[model samples]
Target: MPQSHPFARVSILCKTYDPESGFNESHAEVIELHDDQPEAVDAVLKYIYTFEYDNIVRTGKDKTRPQFHLRVYRVAHKYQIPKLQHKACTGLDRACRKITLQTSGSKNGSSSEELFELIKLITEHKQYDHSFNTTSIYLVQRYLSPLMRLKTFNE
Candidate 1:
């Protein structure tokens, strides 16, 4: 199929896929050629969601996986978005507290109940405000480990 978007310059010097080594064999074939923005986005999303860094590490200690690019991650740190960072911190704190409570609860006590209590504490504390959309809230909660460490607003 022909790509619908204009071709954009890609910075990759060279790439190779070795399925026996566990890299996505499919992406290996086409990644060397320059691609359009949409194609690049699609490819990156697929790789980030599915590619396992551990698997690549085992393949070769020197070569890192194509999953989350180190360069991109560095850029994120350089131009760090404050609001998102705050949300991330709050989410992490809540997650750590929840995990601790869950682990320390008595063997006879219910894990579900403990989780519910933690949820209650978070809600009562108003860590998330009324303005938070469902998707953003979900993302913050789901990635609580990383997000909770951020300096988020009290509400």
Candidate 2:
């Protein structure tokens, strides 16, 4: 029987095994990770072994950086990995800053349609509520403040 792999030893996945018994002698266990995103899992695994992950900040029309970070954060939280959670949160904050800058600096700013999509994406994820992080709340406030001012004056 083969020994447990090094990567599995440090992860929460290993907690299921009894320390007194060798993992190789135990019955085969199948763990299904249906709720986790493959990309997010890959990123967390890479970070676990290498202490590094791909930057979430990139210029593109996709705007999936925040989504990726959110997914990673969820995975980390589920797996009880504090270090990964911290990294994911930091990445999320950074991505939010980049997104804010991109939208605010645009010649016409983000269109109402784009803003609506952004709001929908954030609100759809429970992890993005006001208590999750200040950056997310700040982003929403920043975008809404201008609209609120315009509406107040127009009324």
Candidate 3:
């Protein structure tokens, strides 16, 4: 682990090759986190241990899948894991693609409607995700904006 990386500074004995376990003899070697979403937390752990998170989360045409990536992005931001944050953003964008998206709030809605909801979600979370200004959000906007224009023309 690189000393400059914030995550490298974390003292996880089993993971970091430290001689000390960090846990007292009576305490279990479990790490506790406060997030309510177990699946997202599991994805985070998978990424940490294996450096691959995409395969673990099989959204499988699920319309609400963007929320999973958002959860991962939030955790990454809180932990200052930039690469994971980027990956989560990529996942969100991929899920919201014109090919995969369903209506945002309804099963019978069109792809354009789903895309609209995704854009709304991105704007709503602009404050929490600092990278929105510098990276993926702009890419999302560039990719989706033209489609939005076309959608208006078609309607």
Instruction: For each candidate in the order shown, give its overall lDDT on alpha carbons.
Output: 0.34, 0.60, 0.61
Model 2 Cα shift for residue 148 (angstroms): 5.7
Rank the candidate models, highest TM-score first. Answer: 2, 3, 1
- Alpha-carbon RMSD, candidate 2: 7.8
Per-residue lDDT of 155 in model 3: 56
| lDDT (Cα, tens digit) per residue for candidate 2, span 1-155 | 66444365465455555555566424557555789988777777777776665443232333246677778878777766666666777766666666543355676345544554554555555553343447646676767654454443235
Candidate 2: where are CA atoms >4 Å away?
A: 1-12, 15-31, 54-64, 100-131, 145-155
Residue 4 of model 2: what lDDT? Answer: 45
Ordered from best to worst lDDT, the candidate numbers read 3, 2, 1
Query: What TM-score, computed on C-alpha atoms, does each candidate reach?
Result: 0.20, 0.59, 0.54
lDDT of 3 by residue, 1-155 (tens): 74345347344324443435554532546656666466667677778777776766664345247767877887777766777788887777675453343446766544655555555566666787654444345534555654556554245
